[model samples]
Target chain A: MSGALLADAPGVLAALAQGASAVLLGLGLLFWFAGSWPLLGRASYLTKLHYLGISDTLGSALMLLGLLLRFQREWPLLVLALLSLVVWNTIFGYVLAACSQPRRRP
Target chain B: MSRLIVIALRMLIWLLLSADPELLNVAIGLAVSLALPLPRRVRALSPGQFWRALGESVTALPQAYSQAARLLLHRRLEESVVHDEPARVGGRASSVLVFLDVFRITLTPFTIALGLEGGGRRYRVHELVFEEKER
Candidate 1:
């Protein structure tokens, strides 16, 4: 068994990586569904936004990690996407929350 | 100056997107970064302040994940309250620092920074806590 595995070590490693990436992708999708399901509920807007943050930023980041693992040669681009997506979406959520507030007289 | 840091950030992003270190590519990246107009005047930002804020933002990523898990697993949410926390670096903080602060706060599932209120002395955070706390 050891000799058989040694002959195709690279192939085995690649298969394992592919399987792991698939799991990560599925998990990220699960996060998206779980987070978004609250939007239809009676929860307040800010609470909904919190759920959105988890789905949009963290879930997407997880998906990006999956892609990064599967496509090692394209790591730089994947990394750029991951960073911008996380920062921009998180900030966007804040903007939405801030705008929802009533203005105070200066 | 904070502007220098902003330019460096742009250049870093450009390099990451292009994935090329050729001389001409570097030159073009620098030129574009300079060409882009920065928002109304950046204030002086010390290196220590910049790094500390950046470090906090990085650490927030893991914390954000944990909070996301907590939020997802809990079937009921008790309430969300808007409250103020004394600012760590208050009073006209650099925009970069402000951005990092906002990013760190809003990245987590349990909290969102509503913006600095009460004359920028504190951050007005909207938070959700399901479990009761013993006072």
Candidate 2:
């Protein structure tokens, strides 16, 4: 019985990983929608930019994590993508916010 | 110290991109890392300072998720304010430290570092605060 359980371990682990990947992907989608929903409202531009950071950076990061779990063999590429995406998008948001402000020598 | 970080970063990227663990590949990666031109006038950075900044940046990841959740759940926005936050490092922070500081600040949904002000001593951050009536 112990040997049989041991033999089934990989299958069980794979199933668990698959389930976790799905959950992460679902959460990422929910975040994306929730963040983007405010864009249609009358919120100020800076507020909208704040929401954009949530959607573009955090939501996408969740999705990438999901992908990383689902496709374990592609981890290196996924990691590189995750790092660049998070850093680049966050800085891009800052640039947008900075550019929107009135020019003041600092 | 900063030069070491640049080379280390380049080597990391090269290894990630190549995904090869062979000796030849590693040798070539090291060669490429050294051959690449580093930025001019990189400010001095101590190991302690570098590690601290790195740790803070990583910590911001979980903080970002929590902040995002809060922002989404609390739909009512009280107001947007541009606040000045003093730099985390001591006087004359290096560019890498500044970049990491900016990354940590802007990663969350509530705040974005507009730019550094007061002679690179403080970050001009635009922040959003949500209404706290539900609490």
Candidate 3:
């Protein structure tokens, strides 16, 4: 019994990791869908942009994190990608919000 | 002092990206880090402020997630303009606080800042659900 448990330990750990990765990926997809659905409604451009940008950023980050867990050897690249996503996404969202604002009259 | 820190951080990132600890890679990273122009005013958060922001974010995450989930599950979309009351914090600190608020709110799927209004003192935020009391 002890031998069997020892033999299955690695397999169990691997399966656990795989399951976690899949769950993360699924949650990411769900966020994407949730964020996108509101865009088809009567919300204004700014509202739509909000949902799309925030959800997309979170979803992408979650997906990258999932991949990072599944592929530990490529952590360097994955970490870089995740950092880029956070910084770039925020900057991009700021730019979009700024551009959408009304200009002040002289 | 901040410039040196920035350069060191860049070099570290360069090393990570290169994934090689060879002398040549290190030298290249050093050179690149030195070549990059540092910001004129590098803002460094105090440890206290950093901890506050971290704690605030930890507390806000669940609220944001539930808000998003509620919005999505109900398919309810509402638009209302809200302003952030003026904060007592001044100058760069206030700006940093505003940025932190924006970042925290946007991290959730429910709320997004449209723009800074009232000369950057107030943020015009669009929420997934509109609250009449705030309007």
Candidate 4:
């Protein structure tokens, strides 16, 4: 029993990591799809934007995290990508909202 | 000085994305970074304000998630208009503040900024769930 445990320890750890990565990826896709599903409804554009933007941001972050875990050696790039995703998404959302508003005459 | 810093930071990001530390790659990254134009006004946030905003955002995350979850579980969609007053006088500073406000509010799934109203002094938000007292 002890010999078997020692032999399989590395395999067990690898399997665990793989499982975790899969779970995170699944969750990310779920968030993305669920958020987008609301867009088809009768809600207004702003409402749809709320659901889509927030979910897309969170989804991308989660997907990146999953990839980060899977590719632990490339974490610096993944972390930077995640940061850019969140920052740019929020900024773009603001831009879209600001642009959608009717311009007031001076 | 800040513009140089910005360019340097952009170069660093470019290098990271490229993942090639070769001389040619670095030169190209530097050139590209330098070519990007800087904004007319750079209102640098003081460390204190940055820290405060970071803290507030950290605390706000859970609330945002809970609200999103509630919205997801509920079948009915209710729309309501809400007004937000700018904390500063209207100008570039106020515009930056408004942008930040929109980002913060839209981070949550329940609310979106519909438009700026009342000469950009107020924001009109469309909320998924609105309470009477909030109006």
Candidate 5:
């Protein structure tokens, strides 16, 4: 095969990976922006929960995924563990917040 | 000799956790030396007191270790919530627990920003509040 043919496969793969990373980055950015907007107004307790929960979990997950993709390592097991820990940490925050709050009567 | 052993062990643990081992060793050694417990005859303390202290510390150690590990590993709180009740205290942020020993207060990432030992005791903390109410 000619040199041009040899390079085409890798170039297309790189472009595809870049496109995927951009999408992931944009999604994470959107989550973060939406979650933080409530700080400007009189934010309620529920609002605060919404802000922290979505941003903390989904945004962080997306960000971590993007980072892993960028690294493009073959260590699948390590990556899975890292992602799980990040998600767990995010959920744990929500749990702590919930436990700290006083229960309301029906 | 026995007293010296106890002091030395305590110093070792402090050193392991501390950033400046030399400074902590000096400080702890000085404090222990200055505040050495009275002789067994002079103090006439009951043996039960020693056992009680040992038991309490033994129970507290695992908890302190887990809390410290969580801090080091960046483990987030499992549950945290904010509810506005009739303000028993004036400000939203009031009543900080310092040196409570409940959750390994010493080695936590949050350090006491300011403390006042007036009527009782008061502390101001500068911690990264993952969640806090604005008002």
Candidate 6:
């Protein structure tokens, strides 16, 4: 049974490979924390945004790409759909915010 | 029929990525099971509102698709700067939800989220570059 499961595994190994990068990212974050990176400790708002935004987006996207690659055969549509939904949600959120906001007179 | 198909496909994708098919089924069943009974508070004057909302969603599919495609074609615009004048406050929190909603907005390419505070109000915004209209 275990062997059969392994044989049917779509991107099981790829998932594991992606997991490795997750570990790398986690480690980098740890190093930054341990070194008390000035940005992490008390950086200005925009600076902090730069750090967290880059890390969060790249880390998440890399992890998703790995998973998608692994699961490509069995669930290609699902992967695309999930990615589309995430993108759409972000777009909708921006649109909603923009619509609700007022422009300044300058 | 199309609506059901869309819902089912969405459910399947969610289930697969979540890596838990049974949980997905259970959640869906639970949602359907619970949705039939309206709590007293939400028992609206007319049920037409629900159908109206559904119709709106059905009609919006084409627009959503176009928007999605347009967005995909471009590199994400991540940050924008907004210069906001001060805001005045009424009670301790009339604008609280509005403030929270604005700050919560984030984008893809270069949009910077600004948390606003002023005379009495709060806002969150991103600045975008658009050309001024002539005349």
Candidate number with greatest TM-score: 2
Instruction: Judge candidate 4 at residue A80 and give its lDDT.
Output: 85
- Tens-place lDDT per residue, model 1, A7-96, is 999999999889989988988998999999999898999999999998899999999999988998999999999988998999999999
Q: Which rank order by TM-score, best down to worst?
A: 2, 1, 3, 4, 5, 6
Candidate 3 stretches greater than 4 Å from native: A104-106, B1-5, B21-31, B42-45, B54-64, B85-88, B94-99, B116-122, B130-135
Residue range B8-111, candidate 5, lDDT tens digits: 54554444444354766669755865476733423222345444434553465344333323333443433333222221122221122221221222222222
After superposition, the stretches of candidate 2 with alpha carbons farther than 4 Å from their true spots are: B133-135
Candidate 3 per-residue C-alpha lDDT over A1-106 given as tens digits, one digit per residue, 9 for 90 to 100:
9999899998898888889999988898988887887788877777777677647777777788899879989988899888778657855776686687787442
TM-scores for all predictions? 0.91, 0.95, 0.78, 0.72, 0.37, 0.33
> For residues B1-135, could you state the per-residue lDDT of candidate 6 as single tens digits?
323333554555555555555766759754664454433332122334334434544454444333323332342334435665333332243232232233223433233334444533644444433233112
DockQ of candidate 5 is: 0.03
Error of 2 at A14 (Å): 0.2
Ranking by lDDT: 2, 1, 4, 3, 5, 6
**Runs with alpha carbons beyond 4 Å of true place in candidate 1:** A1-9, B132-135
Evaluate candidate 4 and give its CAPRI docking class based on DockQ: acceptable
How many Å off is the CA of A37 in candidate 4? 1.3
Q: Pick the candidate with the highest DockQ.
A: 2
Better of 1 and 3 by TM-score: 1
> For model 4, how does the per-residue alpha-carbon lDDT over B1-135 read when each residue is reduced to its tens digit?
346556877987887788888999999998888788876777554445444555665665566666666666665665555556453435434333455566666676666666666665666665666432233
Q: How would the docking of model 3 be graded?
A: medium
Which residue pairs overlap in candidate 3's backbone? Answer: none
In model 1, what are the clashing residue pairs, if there are any? none
For model 4, state the Cα shift of residue A34 in Å: 1.3
Candidate order (DockQ): 2, 1, 3, 4, 6, 5
Clashes of each: 0, 0, 0, 0, 9, 10
| Segments of candidate 6 deviating more than 4 angstroms | A1-43, A73-106, B1-105, B115-123, B126-135
**CA RMSD per model (angstroms):** 2.2, 1.6, 3.8, 4.4, 16.5, 12.4
